[model samples]
Target: MLLFITIGALCLLLTIVGDLVKLLQLSKLFRCISGSACSDELQQQLKEARVKVERVRQSSNATSHYTYTVKLMRAENELKAIQTKLRNESNMQNLKGASVELVVGYLLKGVLSLVLFIITLRNRYTPVFLFNENINFEPLEGLLSFPTGVHNAISVPFWALSCNSAFRLLFNAIKGK
Candidate 1:
């Protein structure tokens, strides 16, 4: 489980790094065309730069997609292996039940971690006002809150659903139906 978590984290990091690199490269490509234009040579250079940026963007996108697919498949395989191991170790017939328990455990842990992180961050950065005498608003609050809220709200449900689907497939595999 720890290994799977680490792999997932690494995959996420790689995806983010790949995205940032692509964006930076695209920015540089755009910056290359910032001079006074309309000359034939300048126009040709801009056209070529645009083409190269497009190609780079497409390739990066394809690579990102491929990496995600591979990671997902690997995760699925790991889950399947866990299920098999559990079955072989115990003669329990309630594989679905066990899967449900596993999913619930994961969801609870993830949500708790998110809540703790948010609380810690809020405590660290948010100013505590006394008696509502004065209020201070930081410009970065919205930026920070939006992503944390969005990630916790979106990713938890997405992962839960994916786990449920994966468990269903595992069930099917187990029944040999």
Candidate 2:
């Protein structure tokens, strides 16, 4: 249906916008980290730590500089991995995409219901011609209103479940389990 398609398109657009915002935030965070103004004492501490580390490396009598360099690189990689894990956990807790998708799905469902209502009106008996046996019309109208509410009610839980399942799968794949 045109209504459902339109709704899906709009939801896709919203998802893109949300992703862009996230990317922007990440960029901003990176810039902040690179541009931060550290106190002189902290800078001094870092310098001293670097010097101490270098001294320790030199005293260790490692066979080659290559070994020290490789070890340093591996430590950096581990630190990055830990930071990435923390960020991912925080993002999951926020459920940013799930919230956005839930809203979009509900809106789409409402549109679908409205379109159905319009179609029903176009084909139904004239409003003015109330036959004696048309006592069911009021109840039918009530029934017609149910789809929109049902759609909204179902979307949040559906999205939540989907996201949870998807994340679990992703986690398993990442862990090679």
Candidate 3:
């Protein structure tokens, strides 16, 4: 049926689009691809902090003057502070990005599934495919016929499920995962 085919295509399209969006991973892509100005600046600061600590350490023997100890401790503390800042910044960005992606993925799935549900309800009495003695199982025939009460006819709900299952399986196979 045209309705069945169109609905199947829509489901396939949505599944592909959702996977593509997941693959894009835009937030992490932007942050990782360029690691842009802010991250670069932080990296530069981290390097300078390490250099400062090393310079101070090299300025004196490990057990030299009290002034040297104070300088070395201060430099090391600065280096540690910078390292912690960089770690925290990266962790926060990852958490925020993942959270946003999770929320968006959840909403997209919910809304699209809702649309499919509405369509299925509207076409509850419609037969997605008609068969003549193709399947002889009574319970299955009863279920496949669904609201239409037509023996050996598949309904929209099962068709939708089959479409989603087949497409997702094909997609994963193509992705080699």
C-alpha lDDT of candidate 1 relative to the true structure: 0.43
Estimated TM-score for each candidate: 0.20, 0.26, 0.74
By the TM-score metric, which is better: model 1 or model 2?
2
Q: After superposition, how far is residue 92 of candidate 2 from its true place, in Å?
A: 3.9
In candidate 3, which residue pairs get closer than 3 Å at backbone N, Cα or C atoms, i.e. clash?
none
The top-ranked prediction according to TM-score is 3
Model 3 off-target regions past 4 Å? 9-21, 30-37, 61-64, 133-139, 162-177
Residue-level lDDT for 167 in candidate 3: 85
Give the clash count for each candidate: 0, 0, 0
- Between candidates 1 and 3, the TM-score winner: 3
Off by over 4 Å in 1: 1-93, 125-177
Write the residue-wise lDDT of candidate 1 on 8-40 in tens digits.
443343323433344445433433443224334
Give the residue spans of candidate 2 off by over 4 A: 1-86, 126-177
The TM-score measured for candidate 3 stands at: 0.74
Error of 2 at 167 (Å): 30
lDDT of 3 by residue, 8-70 (tens): 876887677666567779668645754467778889998998898888878887556998989
